[model samples]
Target: MNSRTKSINELILTAKRDGRSVKYVSDGYHTFDELYYHRMILFSVICHANKDRAWKSWLHDDGTIFNDTFIVGIQTDEGQYTYHYKTEYWDMFQVQEVPRAPKYDGHKPKDITRLLTL
Candidate 1:
């Protein structure tokens, strides 16, 4: 197994033990202190990709395997936002592009569509 796969596996195990839902934030807008949330997001993203193979070959040839860290934040009832961590530098992290779900040419069949159709 490769480093990325190993890391992902370890993360998956951690998430299973903690019992938290995973989310993916490509914008790198989260803080490091929210390690649990971050790990959860990463796991979700990887699992969505369906590349859960244990070998390194599962990753893309470019060597990039979903680059973004997870962070925690809370939205206030008054419409304000708060981060879990305080820092002087916020621009250091760059936003990443998440994979888009395959689009259907027209209305999708109910059996295959995971999303609800209007």
Candidate 2:
């Protein structure tokens, strides 16, 4: 496994436990802190491309897995809005609460499609 990927994963675990957020906005991946910002973007793209639009992370070596996903973007005929994507791919992801079916009350014919948790 790539050490960079491993370090990034560890940082995410720590952040979730502390209930705090990180902000590392450099392209350099030499340090654990530097991986925060880039990890968010990379994971979003990966999740968005996946068939199920979710990422499975084995947080510990014990083999337990957690599903992670997020809303990456929204689009309508008016414009497109890309999410800032602040969460990590493997952090406390995927809401545990049961989801309710959506209600599209007054959307026009050119309504936006679903903004999936990718």
Query: Candidate 2 at 55: error in angstroms?
Result: 27
Clashing pairs in 2: none
Give one digit per residue, the lDDT tens place, for model 2 in 19-90: 866554234645446664555555455545542434232231243223443333323344333222333543
Residue 71 miss distance in model 1 (angstroms):
34
| Model 1: pairs clashing at backbone N, Cα or C within 3 Å | 22-40, 23-41, 31-71
Would you estimate the TM-scores of all the predictions?
0.20, 0.25
Candidates' RMSD to native: 19.0, 14.5
lDDT per residue (tens digit) for residues 2-118 in model 1: 998798778867876898544441226654446645654543344334322111111232443333422222112222111211222222222232242122233223332222111
Candidate 2 stretches with Cα past 4 Å from truth are 25-118
Error of 2 at 87 (Å): 17
